[model samples]
Target: MGNSSSSLKVCTDHQGGINWLSLSPDGQWLLTGSEDGTARLWSTADSQCRGHFQGHESYITFCHLENEAAFTCSADHTIRKWDVMTGQCLAVYRGHTSIVNRILVSKDYLFSGSYDRTARCWSVDKEKPIQEFRGHRNCVLTLALYSSQDLLQDSEEEESEEEKLSKDFLVTGSTDCTVKVWWVSSGRCHQTLLGHTGAILCLILDAPNRELFSGSTDYTIRTWNIVTGEQLRVFKEHQGSIICLELVNRRLYSGSTDRTVKCWLADTGERVRTFKTHKHSVSALKYHAGILFTGSGDACARAFNTKTGILQRVFRGHKLVINCIQIHNELLYTASHDGTLRIWDIRPLCKRGKRRLKKERSLQGRSSQKGSLSRLFNNKVGCVVHQEDGREQETVELM
Candidate 1:
C-alpha cells in the first residue's frame, strides 16, 4: 500500500482498543470509550488527549455525547455519566445484568440496550432506571431514538397525526431477530418488527422520510415505515452480515462482514453501488459530503468516492480492527481496536489523485459469522484460502 500517513494524526493515550466514539454537539471535542476501562476526551483541533475518566471495571463499549454531559456503557454492567467540561464521573447508572452494548440520549431520557435481553430508559439525573423494556428472547445489540423534535427541526412539512402519535419513541434491535418500538413516556410497546433470519447489528433513522433502516446478520437491509410500522422494502446485496449503516443525500450505505460497502437508493431500496475493497470484515462506515469512509478488521480505514465507489486514499495507523467512526464538520474521526483514535485532514485527499485506483475484491467468499462481536474480534488464529488455486493460507493476526 502507498503511504498516506502524513495526512492524518493519531491519538495514542488509551491502553486498550477503543470501542466507541462520539462528538460533542458543538463539534469541538470527541469522547471515546476503550477496552482499557476508561473514557477519554480529545480536542478535535489539535488531535490531542485533553482529559480521561476512569471507573468502569471492564471494557467500555458505547458512548453518546450531548451538550453538557457524555454517557458511556460498558461490559462492567454499568453506565457512567461524565461532565463534558471536567471529565469527572458525575453519576453511575446500573441495572443491566449483562454487558451494555449501545446507548441513546434524547431530550430528558437515556436509553441502553444490553445482553440481558432487555432495554432500559433512565432519567439523566437519577441513578435508577425509570422503565425497562422486556420481550426479546436474546441480547439487545443496538438502540435508536426517534423524537417529534427531529421531524420539526429540518423539514418544512407541516405536522401530521403520525408525527404527533408519540413525542418520543425508542427502537431496540436484538439478537432475537426482532426490533421493538416503545413509547418512551408510557413504556407501551408500539410495534414489533419481525423478519430478519439473523441478529440485527445496526440501525439508522431517516427523519425526513419517516422510515427506519435496519441492517442484520441475515445479509439484508430492510426499510420500514415508522408511522405505519410496515416493512416497505428490503435491500439484499451484501454477502455477509452488515455491521454499519450510513445515510446521506437520500442514499443508504452499509458496511458488511463481506469486506465491502454497498450504497442503495433510500426510497426505492435498489442497490446503487458496491465498493469491495477491504482485506477483512468491515466494521464501521460514514458518508459525508459525497465521500465514503470505511473501517475494517484488516486494520485500515479507507476513503472512497460516493459516486463511483473507487478507492481514494488509505489511512494506516491502527494495529487492529477499527470499531467506530464519526465526522464532525470537516474533521474525520476513527476509533480502533489498536487502542487509538485518529483524526485525518481529508481536504488534501478529497481532491483528485495521481492514479485512478480500482477496488480490490477477492474471489474467495467470506466465512459465516456467529455470536456478537466475533466477526470484528477473535483471539484464535484464522485461515484464508486462495481462490485461484484452492490452497489454504494462514491468516495474519491483526489483533
Candidate 2:
C-alpha cells in the first residue's frame, strides 16, 4: 500500500476492537462503540478523548451520536443514552431478549433492530418501547427511517388522503432475506419486501426519491420502491457478499467481500467504475467532496477519485480490519478492530491532486456536476439468532 503515515494521528484507549463510529452533526465530535463494553466521545479538532461512557456488561455493537447525547447498543441486550459532555448514563432501553444490532435516532424517537427478530421504536423520553415491530422471522440486522415530511417537500401537488395520513416509516432488513417497512405512528407493517435469497447486510434510503437500497450476502444490491413495495432494480456484479453501500448524487457505491468497490448509476443500474486495489474485503465506505474513501479487512483505508477512478492515497498502520470511517473538515477518521481511532490530515495531500485533476478535466472540455470532484476542501448489520459457546462472536456492523 502507498504510505501516508506521517499525517496520521492515533487515539488508542479502547481495550477492544471498535465496532461502529458516528460523527456529531456539527462535525465537532466523534462517538465510537467498542468491544470494550463502552463508548467514548472525542473531539474532532484535537483528536482528544472528551468523554468515556461505560456501563454495558458486554461489547457494544453499534452507536449513534446526536447534539446532546450519545446512544450505544450492546450484546448485553440493552441500549443506553449518555450525556455527550458528562458521559453520564441517562437512560437504559431494555426490552430485546438478544443482542441489539443497530440503532437509529430521528426527531423525538429511537429505533432499534436486534437478534430478538424484532424492531422496536421508543420515545427518547421514555424507558420502554412505544411500539414493537414483530414480523421478521429472523434477526433484524439493519434499520433506517424515512419521514413523511420528505414526501411533502418533494411534491407540490395536492396531497391525497393516504399521503396526508402517512406517518414516518421505519425500514428493517433481516437475516430472513426480507425487508419490512413499518409505520412509526401505528407500529403496523406497511410493506414486506421480498427478493433477496440471503441475509441482508446494509441499507440506505433515498427519501426524496422514495427508493431503498439493500446490500446482501447474496452478492447483490437491490433497489426497492418503499411506498409501493415494488422491486425496481438489481445490481449483481460483486463476486462476494455485498457489505456496504453509499449513495451520492444519484450514484450508488457498494463495497463487498470481493475485495473491490463498484460504482453504479442508481437510476439506470449501470455499472460505472470499479476500484480493485484492496487486498481484502471492503468493510466500510465514506464519500466527501468528490472523493470516495474506503476501509477494508486489510487494515487500511484508501482515497479514490470518483470521476477518473484513480487511487489517490492509502492510509496504513492499523493492525486489524477498519470497521468504519468518517470524514470531516479535511480530516479522515477511521475506526478499526485494532481498538484505535486514527485521524489523517487529508488536506495537504488531496488538494494538490484535486487541482491537477480539475485542470486536466477543464482542458478535456469536461464539465463537473453540482457536487463533483472539482469541488474540494469539503468537510463532511447482520442478523441470526445462533448462540455461541464462550465469548460472543464478533461481526461487522456499520452505519
Candidate 3:
C-alpha cells in the first residue's frame, strides 16, 4: 500500500517536547505537561490555548485531569493542581524528595510515585497526603488503579460482612523489575508480580476482562491474571525495548525502540500486524475507539489504523520528539521532548472516512488439466488495508 503522510494536518506548534497529556473527564478541555516546567489548558472545539500554569521548577512528567481541575507531577519534586477555566494554581502538593515519575487519580485520592522509591496517596480536595506507600527498591515508572468491584468479588465474604466496605487498590511498576499491587486504604501490599528481566515501563489493567498487561525494557509485553497473579502470556519479538502499550477490543498494541508498533491477538498471542510509524523509538501510545495515536523520538505525533496497520496521518510541529498523546472527545493533546505542550482541534481530522486500497490485477493464466486446476485451486486473495476512517479495506484479487 502507498503511504500518505501528507493527508494529515498539523493543528498547532510546540517548541519543546511534550512529557504527558490528558483530556478533561467532562470532555470540555485538554491538558498537557512538559519539560518546560509548564502545563496548559485548551478548548476542545477550537484548540485555543485557554491558559498556562508555570509553577513547576523542573520538567513536568505526568498530568491528570479531574472535573474542572488538573494535577501535574514534575521532576521539580512537586504536584500542583490548576483551574481548567482560568489556569490558576489551586494547590501544590509537595513532599517527595526525588523526581516524580508518574501520578494516578481516583475520585477522592491522588497518588504520586517517585524515584525516591515511594508512593504517597493524597486527598484530592484537601491536597495533602493521607498515606505513604514505601517498599519498592527503585524508581516507580507507572501506577494503575483497580475498581472497588474487583476487590469485592476477589475477597471471601464473611457472615457479618460489611456491605459498603471501603476498598481501593493501586498497582505500581518499577525499575526494580517488579509490579506491586497495594491496598490504598490500609497501605498493605496485595501481590507482587515478577516476570520481566528489565525495568517495567508501563502497566495497564483491563478490568473488564480481569487481565493485566505490562511493557518492559526487556523487549516484551507480558499479560497476567490480576486476581490469580499467574502469567498468562508473553509477547516477545521486538528487536529493541518495548516502552508503551494500549489495548482495544481483544487486541494488544505495543510500541518499541525498534521504531515500530505491533498488534497482537490477546487470546492467542499471535502477531497480527506491524507498522513503522516513526523513525526513532516510540515512547507512548493512546487508543480510543478504533484510532491509534502515537508519540515518538522522531518529533512527531501520528495516527494509524488499529486493525489494518496502515499509517494514516503524520503530525509534524513539535521541535523535539513527542513524549505523550491523549485524545478526549475530539481534541488531541501532545507533549514533546523540547518542553512545551501543544493542543489541536482534531475534530475535523478525526472524522476521516474509511480508507480505500488500490485493487491489484490478478494473473489470468489458466491451468491446462482439470486435475491440475482442482489441485491448484486458489480462492480470492484478499489483504486488509488500512484507511483513514479507522476501518480496514479488503482488496480482493481474483485469479
Runs with alpha carbons beyond 4 Å of true place in candidate 1: 1-3, 148-166, 351-399
Which residue pairs of candidate 2 clash?
327-380
When 1 and 2 are scored with lDDT, the better candidate is 2
lDDT of 3: 0.75
lDDT of 2 by residue, 38-68 (tens): 8999998888999999999999999999989
Please write out the lDDT profile of model 3 over residues 164-220, one tens digit for every residue: 354677889999999988777767777889899989988878887788899898889
What is the C-alpha local distance difference test score of candidate 2?
0.87
Q: Assess the local accuracy of residue 83 in candidate 2 as a C-alpha lDDT between 0 and 100.
A: 91
Q: What digit string (tens of lDDT, one per residue) describes model 1 on residues 167-274? A: 788899999999889877667787899889999998999987888999999999999877667899999978999899988867788989998888887878878689
lDDT of 1 at 275: 89
Query: At residue 33, what lDDT does model 1 achieve?
Result: 91
RMSD of 2: 12.7
TM-scores for the candidates: 0.82, 0.86, 0.80
lDDT per model vs. reference: 0.80, 0.87, 0.75
Residue 386 shift from truth in candidate 3, angstroms? 33
Stretches off by above 4 angstroms in model 2 are 1-4, 152-166, 353-399
